[model samples]
Target chain A: MIHIRRDVCGYCGACVSVCPRGALELIDAYLTVDETLCKSKCKICSTVCPLGAIELEEQ
Target chain B: MKEAYDVLVVGGGPGGALAAKAAAEQGLSVLLVEKRPAIGAPVRCAEGIGKEALAEFIEPDPKWIAADLDKAVLIGPDGTKFTIGNNHSGGKVGYVLDRKVFDRELVWQAAEAGAEIQVHARASAPIMIDGKVSGAVIHQHGKTYEVRAKVVIAADGVESKFAKWAGINTTVPLTELETCAQYIVNDIDIDERANLFYISYTDAPWGYIWVFPKGHRCANVGIGIAGTKSGEGHRAKDYLDRFVAREFPNGKITELIVGGVSVCKPLECTVADNLIIVGDAARLSDPITGGGIYNAMYTGKLAGEVAAAALKKGDTSKMALMVYDTTWREGPLGHALARNYAVKESFIKMDDAKFNSIIHSMSDLSLDEITVKSLVIAIFKANPWLALELPRLLMTL
Candidate 1:
């Protein structure tokens, strides 16, 4: 259940820095979910995005 | 080591060094500490000081000044602009300094007045005895030692955490914060006579972009955006990077610095038993402009004197330290800061069109005539809609 939209986002990469699951990387200044390292164990990454730009993997 | 002193100043930056200088000048025993191995290594500031601030606090030494400026250019959100000159003093409309040498000059003044200083001595926690500040626990060369003192003045900069240990509320709300990222670049074209303040409502939000020229050749180009508007840490920096790429497609990126600015009111209380807070620690930073080097030095001097007086009376109570607050509020630095907060809150509401109109109205003013408030007034005059929005803006700030 990821929930990020690229158009309105500022590309600050706060999610990339705070991601515990190593699920994100900066792509053109916005976050790009790296499926290889992502674990849906917790949704902390989605919750901390200030712009509400984070998307989650489905449960 | 149970070494005792009359006053202990922490952090070797501008405020700390000046506080130590002021205390030493007043004939007090003082010990100043810097965590770094050298006095002014790893520079972090844009190095712009107004003339009004410098003259009132410390005299300029030729050894540290890089250039003397007499003009400023305020570029509005929509690219409309104006310049001002000959209207301020102390780090005023002039002087891009060599901050490393400048910082050393201040500390040197304290040493000239006989204050003991220790470099490479990193102060950790404040030493409290029965609710009284005794001194501090310091770390250096991989070992911890204790130094006891009658009073301590906290002149640590914006990212300070020392006040929390002493029980002072030092948190600054995000809306009043500015996230800045700057690159000191060479081969950039600029007026040697004018300091640039570039702004935009959508881009910087509550803050503005600054391109301060170091000389005729290089400049410190940076952007400051309201931290809360991004609603996320680091977004402001990313915006700065984008802004840079879009504007200076060919300029080489040299040095980069990322930091935050506090444009909020100073804390209600900056003093505690045997403890006095000065400069960035107390949020004396101008809410609108995000400048605090002057306030830091001014408060540093006062804190030094107040600490000495408190010890003279054998009373190290927080009440004695309150004198510093009273001293500052009655003076130019505090009064100017108070007036600035009101003006800063108003400008934060302006959009790009509003900004352009304001700048368009004042395209002919000299450096002496340009001011943050005057520009807001122009915006209100051109668009009565802006005039009606003042009340809401006041409340938000």
Candidate 2:
């Protein structure tokens, strides 16, 4: 699973752009993750987040 | 809102606003939707744009002009400084903008041109009919509307969900994506007439730090790094914090903004059946500078013109829309993108020593015209070793 620290997130949508699965979306200023589509192994979003808001957690 | 329209534009940034305005002016019923509560708030841009490029779209307004820069200063990794006057650079480096007000002015113009505008409207999914984007499912104010349209312009920006939903591969590779963080800092002494850019491989790998003046004693201080270089303690914000602590210790942070820029090439094709993608959604930002304002507005206006013409001809297919892609690619904007991408690739691979050498070499040059080609030529004359190191960059020029 991907853990999003909303408090730290700037809602810049950098993670959403690099998500190959198209699993991340920035609705206004809130970031949402589609669990079913999100692949934990692909940590592209985690790496690209300028604020380090998204993290991959062990299921 | 009507159940159908001639054109539907997603997003409310400069791109979507211009698209709506252009299409609506052509007598097309256009609907422009923004997910945000207002047109432009919580701004995400560095807000610097060239004076002439901007004049092509709208006249200059004092309300939105933060500062009229007369020169640009480049600081190398080893602190070698090189200054380029605005006239020497062909007046390319110009105003720093107040995007919050600038974007609203654009949206206002669109509305005045008869484009129906709606805020708090989010497009959750593309209404695909047999794989063709007919419209979108817009969620607004706790309700969803299945809006239909003859043409859909996806100006949804770097997040760009609409294009991906409509089946365009809009993913920016980690190495190619520039992660940026910025702060609106006040009470700092600065040369307001000059935009300062600091290039340091150790500090901001594959990107640069900038201080664009907003007004006296205030500026947009920011840094960007390649997405692949960002991590837990080495994120764009981390580097930015370090720079701010050193440069502007007494500066007050009034606002903080972070975002991603696709420094890769534009989309392979910007159109599909009944669809057109413009602006950051199409990844048209400058590869070297990470600037997208002019590119977004340029493509937005072009897309609107193309969409309107196609609708009048009663053909909204991909074949008809390819003109939008072809026209931009063949024009000056496209040529600059290609050349700059090559320059960016070469520059990012260079070490601190190479950067210092290049800046040192150019510090004494007095070129009347300061284009990229002239700069490269000057560097070759001063440091012939660089040609051997980056022959590919020279080949592109």
Candidate 3:
């Protein structure tokens, strides 16, 4: 699963653009991840976050 | 909102604003929607642009100008400083913009030209008909509207979803992406008229820190690292905080902005059936400087002009809108982007020693403006041996 630290997320939508599965969405300043579509091992979003807001949690 | 319009523009950044302005000036019914409640609040940019490039779009205004820069200072990884002043940089350098006010000014101009403007309006999905984008479903202040248009322009900045929703692949490669963090720091002692850039692999790997004066005792202190180098402990903010602590310990941070910049090539094709993509959405940001304000405005104007022409002819197909794609690719903007991307590719691979040597060699040399040709010539002059290894890169430019 993907864990997003709301406090750290800048809501810049960097993660949404790089998500291969289109699992992330940035509605205004709020960023939401559809976990059903998120792949925990991918970690692509976590890697691209400027603030290190997104993290991968082992299921 | 009207059920239909001659043009629909999504994301009210410079690109969308310019597009809306151009199309509406042509007597087309234009509608521009911005997702944010305000036009340019929470600016996600370093707000620096070449003066000449900006003049091509709008006249220089003191209302939005933060600082008029006549010089640029570059610090090597070893802290050796190289200055490029008016003599080396050409008399007109650039300006550090107050993007918050600047963006609103642009949108206001679009409104003046008869483009219907809507803020706090989000386009949730592309209204597709037979795989062709006709318009979008917009949610504005708790109300939804299925707006249709003869042509749709996607000007959504980075984190572009409009084009992706329309079946265009707009994903930026992780390696080519730049994760960035910035703070508007006040009460810092700074050279108010010069833009300073700090390059350090130890501090910011494959990226650099910038101090662009926002006038007086304030500046936008920022850092960007290659996305591949970003992680838990070494995030862009981590490097920026470290730099700020050492350089401006007493500086007060007033605002923090974090975003991603795509330092990759422009999208494969910036147009599809009934749709056109512009600005950061088209990946037109410079690969070397990571600057996009000029590129966005330039391409946005072109998108609007092309869309207006296509709409007049009653052919808004992929073929008709292809002119927008071709015109930009064949222009000076295209040439600059190509050359800069090549330089970025070469520079990203260099070690700190190479950077130190290059800066050391050019510390006293008088160069003719900042361009790929001039930079390559400088490198050749400093190290004749490097010429043998640069031919392949030169060929691309």
Candidate 4:
């Protein structure tokens, strides 16, 4: 699962654009991730996030 | 509900605001919509604008100015630095604006000109009528409304899909796009002036890094990299983080901005029947510097004027709106953008060694002789081997 540090997120949507699974959406300036659709092992969004807001947790 | 307007503008950035203002000033009922709750939150720019260019639009309001910069320092890959004082005529002098205030002011100006302003309103797609843009379907406050207009102005920024929705090809090649990441850092030691650091293909890839000082102990530190070089394992934020660590170790980041800049030439066609695209949607930003405020205002004003005239003339066809394209491309702003794009293409191909040599050669010339032609001449004089490439580069200019 991915953890989003809401305090650090700038809500710029850079992560949302790079998400391969379309699991991220920015609604009303808040970034929401759909865990159901998000690829568990993939860390593309976490890597591309400028502020290091998105983190992947160990299973 | 107000379901109709003379000109419907999508996006509330400077471009859209100015377009709405201009159209409204001509007695056209205009409505400008912005997706954000506020006009300029989450600023995605480095906030630098050329002094002379900005002067043409409005006087510098202290309310929106972070710093009045009069010099630019260029640092080469080898730590060689050349400083250019903005006191010289024709040199670049500019200001780092408080974009939050600046953008809102423009929107306020639009409202003052009689244009209705709507925040939190996102345009989903163009309202098409027989293959022509009639207006747009907007989603705002959990409800959708079909708004009709005589003309539509798409001033939406880099991620604009309105142009595509209207059947214009706004696709930018990856090589021509620059992915950017910026941080507004506080508690950093910086000169009152700004610095542009060029590091060949290592630190920033094709694009460069900018440290624009805003005020005391605060600045905008950012990096832009060619999109083609920024996928897979590498990203612009990675480069930016490394640069920030190396330069401002104690700096605390107050804001983070990530966005894409289209560094290609302006679209050959910026108009369709009942539709005109301006700003980033039209790719009117400078290809070399990634600065779009002035260009956006210029094109937006022109689009507004042309749209108003077309409405008055009772013809909103593609042929009628083409006057906007012709006038923009033929003006000084268009010519400068085109020239800058050519210079950028030639500059990107030069390696670090070539860039160092060019900077060394440029140091010998006076500020007056630092024109585009002189720079090319200096390059040729330093490396006579590049004579073959010089012609091709010059042809682009």
The DockQ scores of all candidates, in the order shown, are: 0.06, 0.91, 0.81, 0.19
Better model by DockQ: candidate 3 vs candidate 4? 3
For model 1, chain A alone compared with the true chain A gives a TM-score of: 0.72
Task: Tell how far residue B332 is off in model 3, in angstroms.
Answer: 0.7
* Model 1 lDDT, residue B248, Cα: 66
The sequence of per-residue lDDT tens digits that candidate 2 reaches over residues B167-255 is 88999998999999999999999998888889999989989999999999999999989999999899999999999999999999999
True contacts kept of each: 0.02, 0.88, 0.75, 0.12
Candidate No. with top lDDT:
2
Candidate 4, residue B106: lDDT: 93
Give, for candidate 1 chain B, the lowest lDDT window spanning 10 residues.
B365-374
Q: How accurate locally, in lDDT, is each candidate?
A: 0.72, 0.91, 0.89, 0.81
Model 4: docking quality category: incorrect
Backbone clash total for model 2 is 0
lDDT of 4 by residue, B1-397 (tens): 3899999999899899989999999999999999889999879899998788888777889999998776676677776776555555433567899999999999999999999999999887899999999999998999999999999999987766688767777766666777789999999888876545555567888898999989898998998887667654567888888889998999999988887677898888999999999998898888878889988999898899999999999999999999999888998878878887877887886788877876776566444332334545555676666667656766654
Residue B336, candidate 4: C-alpha displacement in angstroms: 1.8
Worst 10 residues of 4 chain B by lDDT: B366-375
Span of ten consecutive residues with least summed lDDT in model 2 chain B: B367-376
DockQ of 3: 0.81
Provide i-RMS per model in Å: 10.1, 0.6, 0.9, 4.5
Off by over 4 Å in 2: B86-92, B367-374
lDDT per residue (tens digit) for residues B1-397 in model 1: 3388888998788889888988888888899987767787556567788765687867777777767777777887666777666545333466777788988888888889889988888677889899777899987777898999888998766655566667776756656666566788777667765788887876677778887877766777787766556645445556677777776666777776655567888878888998888997788988767877888888998899888888888998888788898888777767667767877767677678877876777675443534555555555555566556676543322
- Docking category of candidate 2: high
- Per-candidate TM-score, first chain only? 0.72, 0.95, 0.92, 0.92
